[model samples]
Target chain A: MRVAAVVKRIAKQFKRDRRSLALMMIAPLFVLTLVWLVLDGDDYEPKMGYSEMPQPVIELLDEETQHLEQYKKEEAIDLMKDGELDAFISIEGMTPTTLLEGSEPSVNSAVMRVIQESLKSLKTNTQIEEPTINYLYGSGDMNLFDRVGPVLIGFFVFFFVFILGGISFLRERTQGTLAKLLSTPIKRWELVTGYVAGFGLFTIIQSVVIVAFSIYVLDMYMVGNFVELLVVTILLAITALSLATLLSSFAKNEFQIMQFIPIVIIPQVFFAGIFNLETLDRWIQILSQFMPLTYGAEALQQMMIKGAHIYDVWFEIMILFGFALVFFILNIRVLKKHRSL
Target chain B: MSFINVKHVSHAFGKEKVLEDINLTIEEGKIFGLLGPSGAGKTTLVNMMVGILSPDQGEITIDSTKVPSFDLMNITGYMAQSDALYQELSAKENLEFMGSIYGLKKSELKERIQHVMKTVNLLPHLDKPVEQYSGGMKRRLSLAAALLHQPKLLILDEPTVGIDPVLRKEIWEEFRELQQQGITIIVTTHVMDEADKCDELGLLRDGQLMAKGSPGELKEQHHASSIEEVFLTVGGVES
Candidate 1:
């Protein structure tokens, strides 16, 4: 009954605080939409300038390039330097030598892609052997969004839940409601459980919306069961919530709660499989094992990207749950600071 | 024996002591006030009685049950100095939340919520979110919440802090009514006028009890014209 009361109060408060509700539900969608626009938008169009190119190659370039111009070699170099041309092509010894203004990697890749594709047509006519490519995990067609979308999903859940849960619990302390709560017959653990159960309700709804939007609306990779994805997402959220509540004790106010994000939340992103950790220093990479988001992001990536089942990703899942349990106990112990019981 | 007993209780914050070795007894069915200045350990003492804080030395008991015990907490209502309310929730919702935590049944909670709100004269604004409430109204609402569980003992830390004089009088009247209903109330206040309304008063200063007696007895003992002068005489002569 007490848990239900706390849940009811939290739900009511969420209803009243529409801005926080919108932030939880809409902020991630807004960011994901922006990411989708930038990472998964229409194919990149590279501008090409040709000099001393064969007629057939020029025709291929004309068809592929949105901005194709024939320029003298000197003029092409000037245009490339001016950033007007993505690349300049010149055939040397029957080998197509392309000079690229290679500052932006995305633009450089696009220019190389156009050059390679246009050259492939030439290869088909020459009867030269073409090398084959294969992917072990994801297909060659995968974009940046598809690769990092799983990690991003886990990240948003952890980030938003952490901030909201920390601030609200901290408010309970600053506003004196926590002391009022302790004056009742409710056990300290019951208060912790109530907070978890209360905030857990919203976390469940939040993860559902965030995960569904990322997969269905934003078209992120979703090879695994939706339920399993939600399990990881919710567990990740529980870990965030418990960790936030435990850390809130050291914070005197909401701003101090926010201060924890830099020390606690941001570092997890580095090791959460967003960046390649293969060549990183061994000790630094081992730090991933300690961060809850590492396990959350890893398990989420396993399910969403690799189509793994519960048993396949159960190790990371258990670790995330273990982090939540430890923080939950710590939260209960922290309440001892307010009431010995 | 007194219904509430605080014996040799002392507390400190770091190296600074907040409550000395203080002993006091409060009878049941009386409106007892802890009269003191802002930092006279009134809040700290009341918090100990409500089981929110445990004294560093000695003990407090309510009806032979030691404080800081769960069962002891079950029957004690505490209204903190600050209005500890969920500002986003309506007054009724706040009452319902507190009532539920005290293990009140649905029907009983509803009935008690109505009764407490009426007692505090907040029945009309029960649906308004506490954020919209005036400071005085919020205090009264906190009082109503403290009364919601029908606790036998109510510890109010500066309950009338922001209340207007008329409403403050009405709240004191309600406290008297609650005392008549056999509830023991411990109120903390710095206002001498409010202190005079208590059935008995414990004058505290700098973590020590200066005097404990009926308001009339205290005034007569000090040979003072008012409770303020009585406080000055006791607090002055001792220092």
Candidate 2:
């Protein structure tokens, strides 16, 4: 009966909040559509210019340029120097020479890739050297989304869960229900647990939409199991929920909760395994190790990019769960300050 | 028999005592008022009586068991000063939730919800989301929720603050009807008109019960024509 009441109330609240309903249902779709547009499209089209090139080489140059502009060799170099064009190619004595204007790695790489592809078709006796490139993820075509997908997976889970959970709990305080619940025959754990269970159920749908949208709709490179990604997202949501609710104690109103986002949720993103972490100061790197989202994003990356089985990332999963558990216990203890029972 | 006995209860937060050596016995069916100013610790004392807060000393007994017992929570309804309705939910949904938490069954829950909503005259707006409710409407819905389970004891902390005069009178009439039906009520208010409506009153000031008697008795004892003057006389000389 008690759990039913919780579930029913949760369902009612979910239904009444059309904006949150839109948030949970539409936000993921909006983001996924964005990711789809971002990842599925062509990256950085860099214009290539060739002057006084061989007829066959112009064919090669045409293949390399997104849209080419013909100019005299000197004028092309001038354009390149002035940064009007990305690069200019001029054939001098059968040796391919190039002048460059360089900025923005993606643009630079886009121009370079087409040049290389156009050159690959030629019959040159030059030996192609393949040294060694070890990749833990998709080799080169990994777009902006693939690189940031894991972080975004953790980000949306944390974002919605934090705002929803924090604001709802804050509402409970403002509405006097928190004090009223304290007056009940309820144990301190019951209120905390009920909230977790209620929001936990809601987060299930939220996680599914977020993860599924990122993976299938956005076409983020997910070489691992779908269930594993779901697990990571769900666990991250729980951690976010706990942290939000626990923080709600310190926040007297909605604005205070919003005040927490820059200070609390935003900084965690820097540490959420998005950037390559090896070069950081060892202390800062170790500090990043403490944030729950870091663990969640790491486990997600391992599963999504490395295609590791759950067993390989089980410890990270457990650690994320541990973060949730400790915060939940702290929330239960904190309620005692309001009501001893 | 006394349905509730609060004996020599001295509640304090740290060294500042809120209710000093308070003693009161409430009969099973009557309306009791804890009349005091804003800072008189009415909510604090009531919190102890309901088992939400424990007194550093003294005991509040509900029936035979101690206060704060989970068993007692089933039989007592608490309406806090602030409306406790979930703004995201409709009025009916809020009442149903409060009723279910108190362990009312489906049929009983439905019956009590209708009954209480009718009592507070909120039946017309049952389906609207509580966030859209006006201040007075919210107060009415809150009162309806406190009356949802028909508890043996209803502890209301400023239950009618934002309600209109006409609705306030009507709601008080319903409360009186409930009292006649053998439900014990303890309402707190700083409003003098509300104090006059209680069967008996405890005038509190500065963490002490300055006087305790029927409204008429309190006024006559203090040689005052109005309950407000009775309050000033008792609160001033005592302080």
Candidate 3:
């Protein structure tokens, strides 16, 4: 009953502060929209610069997917360095040599695809074998966004809740409401529980909106049940909110709370299965176990990318729950600094 | 027995001793002022008595119960230097939030909120958000919140700091009325006039209590014409 008051008050405050409410929901949507536009834009067209190319091979290349231009060898290299050209092909004595600007992995792949397509038309007389492609999880139709969408969903929910919850808790200290609270008969655990329950309520709507947007609106992969996805999302949000409140005690103000994002949260994203951790040094790869987002991202990928059921991802769910518990206990313990009671 | 007792209490932040072997006793049903200049540890001492901070050495007891006790917190209403209000919340919501924490029932909470807002002359502004309140109005609103729980012991840390002389007088009058109804008020202030208004004053300087007595008695003992002169003489002798 006592906890209900704090929850109700926080909900009321959120209602009055429309800007923060919008930020919680809209910021993730805005980022998702940008990602959608960038990756789902028209297929990449390679700008192929040529010093001297056979007329037939050039004519065979699709006009829409390849931008063909003639240049001197030196000029081609210069244009490639300046990023105006994806690749340059120069033929000497029926041998084709292609120079590619390999700085961007996606662009390099696009350039190679175009080069292979153009060479296929000319190689009808020769015996050229094509390599077969196979996938363990996703088919060839999957886009880059489809592969990364689950992790991005986990990351956005974690990032926004961590920042907003941390700043609000820090404000409680800087504004002296913490002192006033400690002066009352309210136990330390009660305050911690109140904060988690309050922010937890708001995060319910937040997770639902974000998950629905990603699955239904943006057409990101959702191979698992929607209810299972929500369960993981809400637990992840609880972990984020609890961890933020625990860390807020170490900060003196809102800016200090924000400083945690780059140092604390950003590193989690890097280690949370977003990047390939197998190639990392052994000790560095082990660091992922300590980040709450690591477990969240792993479970989300299992559900969204691999089409794994709840039973398959149960271990990750347990770890996320464990993290939320530890952070919640730490938050209550940290409140002892304000009042021993 | 004294309602509140401090025996050989001392506290320090890191290596700096903010309070040293502080000993005090506050009788029930009286306005006891901790009069000191800024940074003289008035707020620190009040905070310790209210169980917000535990003394490093010695003990404090309220009504014979050791302080820093969760149960003791029930009877204490503390108003810190800052308003400590949720600026986004209306005055009524702020009052209701605090009232609920004290475990006041719905009817009692509503009545107390009305009575306290009326006491602070904030009844009209109860529906307005605290961020829209002026400095003095915020101070008054904080006082109303402190009083909402109907605490038996009210510990106010510089409650009248930003209030005008006229409103300050009115708040002191309210304190007097609360005392008549058997509430013990411990008000801390650097203002000399507010200190003189307290029934008894503890003159503090540099974390030490230089003297404790009624305003008239302290002035007569120091042979000073005003409370400011009395404070200077007492604080000067101790330091």
Candidate 4:
């Protein structure tokens, strides 16, 4: 009964503070859209400059490259230095040598693909058939946005819920409401449960809105069940909420809550499958195991990108549940500082 | 037997002692004021009585039940020094939340909320958000919340710091009426004139109880003109 009162009060507070509600619902969508606009572009077409090439070779290279230009050795080097050319190919001792302007990895790969394809045909002295490309999971049409979309969904849900939940709990202390609450007959567990159920409702709605918008409006790649995606996102949110309330015990105010972004939130993004962690040191890869977002983002990616079923990602789901439970228990323990009972 | 017994209670925060070896008692149906300046541990001592804080070295009991107990908390109403209200919530909403936490039934809570709001003279502005309320109005609302559950013991810390003189007197009248109904009230204040109104006063200075007595008895015992002079006399002797 006491928990119900707390939940109802939080609902009323959210209704009155429309701006915070909007921030939790709309801010993630805004950032996701911006990222999509920047990352969803077509693959890069590198500009290639060649000199002293045979007529037959020039024709073959012209067919392979989109922006093929003829230039003297000196002029091609000048263009490459000026950043106008991606690569320059010239024959030296009857062997083709290539000079690449290699700042961006993607652009470098694109240039190599074009040069390698034309040179392969030249070296074989016959036109070889293209190998049939097949995909076991995501198709060839998947873009950078599709690959990182699930991770972003997980990240935003975790980020916003953490900030909102942490600050609200901290306010209860700084404003003396927490001390006043401890004076009442309410039990410690009841208060913590009230916070979880209260914030849990909003996070459910938040998960639904963000997931629907990403799949329907933004056309993000989704090969999994909508309901399963929501399950992962909501569990991730609960984990974030519990962790946030637990940490709020140590913070004195809102700015201190924000200080957690660098120390807590950002590192998870790097290790949560948004970036490649396989090439990192073994110890660095092991660090990701401790972060809750790593499990959430991993589960989300498996479901959305690999089209895995709920049973397939049960391990990740259980890990997230464990994190929430541990944090929730710690929250109740932290309240013992205010009132031992 | 005394209604409230604070026996050998001593508390410290980190290295600074806030209350030291304090022994005090209050009868049922009396207005007991803790008279002291700021940092005199008045708030700390009252917090221990309300179960918000546990004494490091001693035990406090109300009606023979040790405090820091849920049963005692259910019967005690505490008004903190800070307003401690949800600024975005209306006065009605804040009272309703607190009333329900005390397990007040729906119909009874509504009636009690209205009664308490009337007692504090804030009935008309009950629906107004607390953020819009003036400082005095917020203090009154906090008092109304404490009174909503109809507790037998009321512990108020500086309840009238921002209220005007006219309203302060009116509040004191309401306190008397509550006392008449056999409610035990504990008020902490530095106001000398207000100390004279209590049935008993515990004069505290630097975390020590310099003296404890009825306002008249304290003055006569020290051969002082008023409770303020008595405070200075006892405080001077201790120093």
Predicted structure with the largest TM-score when compared to the true one: 4
Considering lDDT, which of the candidate structures 1 and 3 is the better prediction for this target? 1
Interface root-mean-square deviation of model 2 in angstroms is 1.4
The total of clashing pairs for model 1 equals 0
- Model 3 C-alpha lDDT per residue in residues A253-301, reported as the tens digit of each score: 8888988989889899888887879999898788888888888999998
- Mark the regions of model 2 whose C-alpha exceeds 4 Å error after superposition: A39-45, A48-62, A67-83, A88-100, A103-105, A108-140, B1-28, B54-59, B237-239
Model 1: which residue pairs collide?
none
Worst 10 residues of 3 chain A by lDDT: A57-66
Per-residue accuracy of model 1 over A71-163 as CA lDDT, tens digit each: 888898888888898888888787889888888998888888888877777656677676798776767777888888898888999999999
Candidate scoring better on TM-score of 3 and 4 = 4
How do the residues B1-239 of candidate 4 rate in per-residue lDDT, one tens digit apiece?
Answer: 79999999999999999999999999999999999999999999999999888789989989999988999888899999999999999999999999999999999999999999999999999999999999999999999999989999999999999999999999999999999999999999999999999999999988998899999999999999888789878888531
Report the lDDT of model 4 for residue B214.
98
Each prediction's whole-model lDDT (CA) = 0.89, 0.83, 0.87, 0.93
Can you write out model 3's per-residue Cα lDDT over B75-182, one digit (the tens) per residue? 888999999999999999998998888889999999998899999888999899999999999999989988887789999998997888888888889999999999
Error of model 3, residue A269, in angstroms: 2.0
Off by over 4 Å in 1: A91-98, A116-128, A132-136, B237-239
Q: TM-score for all predictions?
A: 0.94, 0.87, 0.94, 0.97
TM-score of 1: 0.94
Clashing pairs in 2: none
Candidate 3: regions farther than 4 A off: A49-60, A69-85, A101-105, A121-136, B237-239
* 2 or 4, greater by TM-score: 4
Which window of 10 residues has the lowest lDDT sum in candidate 4 chain B?
A: B230-239
Docking class of 4: high
Please state the error at residue A209 of candidate 1 in Å: 1.5
DockQ of 2: 0.65
CAPRI-style grade of the A/B interface in model 2? medium
